[model samples]
Target chain A: MLQTEQEFIRILRSRLEGTLPEEELNDIVSDYAEHFRIGKADGRSEEELFCSLGSPDDVAREIRATHLVKKAEDVKSCKNIFHAMLATLGLGLFNLVFVLIPFILLVVLLLVVFLFGIVFAIAGPAAFIYSVLQILGIPAFAIWQSPVAGVFFSIGITTFGLLLVIGDYYLARFFYRIGIRYLKWNISVITGTEDEA
Target chain B: MNIQFKKGVLEICVLSVLARKDCYGYELVGEISKRIDISEGTIYPLLHRLKDVGYVTTYLQESAGGPSRKYYRLTEAGRKEEHEQKEEWMRFAASVNALLEGKNDAAD
Candidate 1:
């Protein structure tokens, strides 16, 4: 309810406390403190300055999103990018369609590919073992028409599976890179204070 | 102007301002808000982002009747970015203007 500098700083500190590093958080707070100080000295009331600055909550959210995205870029990891995506999603409802849906779809797609690769990889070795057993006079293991051909087929399947797994990895990496760029652009162009005229 | 459109250009505007001369946080916000209606708080975060990317750097400068203020100066990389963005914006604006004018003539 208060539009004082202290209230603005309080909201920012509370919102950003755990997300930003201590030094960086202090630096940001000082920027605002200085802003209020200078504006007041210019004979403007604290409420006028505060209203012009918009909501501190939005400011904190933007800063947190930007920081997380930059961190993801600096340290390449699934967890980092996931956190970055989550942060960006908080920017606006636009992200629910633009960011959240694509993110979920990508994750599901990648998971399905990985699971298929693993199943094929495991099945190839099992089939190879069964074919060898059938050749060694085990009647029940006779699934393939030709044992020699089965061996070749099993090896081919294994190679294909392995390739799929490796391809999925590179695909994930590529999307991770593109996703970071998109999130950066989204933050820069999409989010703004509600006080837009 | 669209809010999203305004936000998209905020970076270029800030870079262009810093390209001209170093400014303290309040001074820079004043310069931009005078021309564009925006949440003045957002500029600080933009400044921080610029600093993070090494596009700008800051130093403390004492004022006549106040404590030291942090002044932001554009880095070499920041200057290059400003020039590129300015050129891109110019071309984009020119084409849009041409299209609008052509449409106006056809309407008449």
Candidate 2:
């Protein structure tokens, strides 16, 4: 394959066009353009410079990952962080084990907690209504041995469920912050090792 | 050198070099690649990340015979980071070296 400056820039631009803003994309492209320009002036062939620069696809991947991660940090959102995680995962197969597995586990864990909270919250209210009906002499809703105790228990359950939901929210947020830091560190430390190719 | 180890230290290397003096993108890549064996392309992304984190700033400076080049200089935060990372790396390296030497002596 031809390792020309044009080819390199094209690959980079294609990879990053939709992900990065135009001005920022242009800025990144210009950096490499300048590098190639300067290197050519130094009497190095385009091939040698391109080879030293390594693969353009790899470069673009790293840039994409970094930019997405930064964007995620700036705008805290599930979508942004998920995009960042996907980008980082593209860096290498190593991330499948290191990033993807943990990410899936965390998501599943959060989802389960959220679902449990929802179930308990909804069930608590329904049970409370049933207990009230039982107290009002509705035999059809007479599941409770003690109507008054059922009322208190249902209220307690509702409060506990609400607390669990709220706690889960904060837990998700805490994990989000920690996850961002870990992704940043992971990108810095784990990336670029594949450049040996 | 282990590639993973090299990748981990690349950020510190860039910071340490920029700490010495401002350098253009190509110049900075040259400075690091001159010693370390890694992709020169990765440095640009690292530089961008540093800039994003408020650790470095860039400016256009005219070169001798060509168009102006983008030069990167460490920000105040960058200098502090460089100092802290350098210290940490030194201590960590020293401990690792000591442990390796002790293990070698025991083996002998």
- DockQ of candidate model 2: 0.68
- By summed lDDT, which 10 consecutive residues of candidate 1 chain B come out lowest? B99-108
Which number leads on DockQ? 1
Interface RMSD of 2: 1.6
Candidate 1 residues A109-189, lDDT tens each?
999999889888988998899888878878756778898898888998888889899999999999999999999999998
Q: How do the predictions measure up, each by TM-score? A: 0.96, 0.95
RMSD of each: 2.3, 2.4
* Candidate 1 fraction of reference contacts recovered: 0.84
Clashing pairs in 1: none
Off by over 4 Å in 1: A192-195, B103-108
lDDT by residue for model 2 (B72-106), tens: 99999999999999999999897788787775553
lDDT of 1 at B31: 94
> Local distance difference test, per candidate?
0.92, 0.91
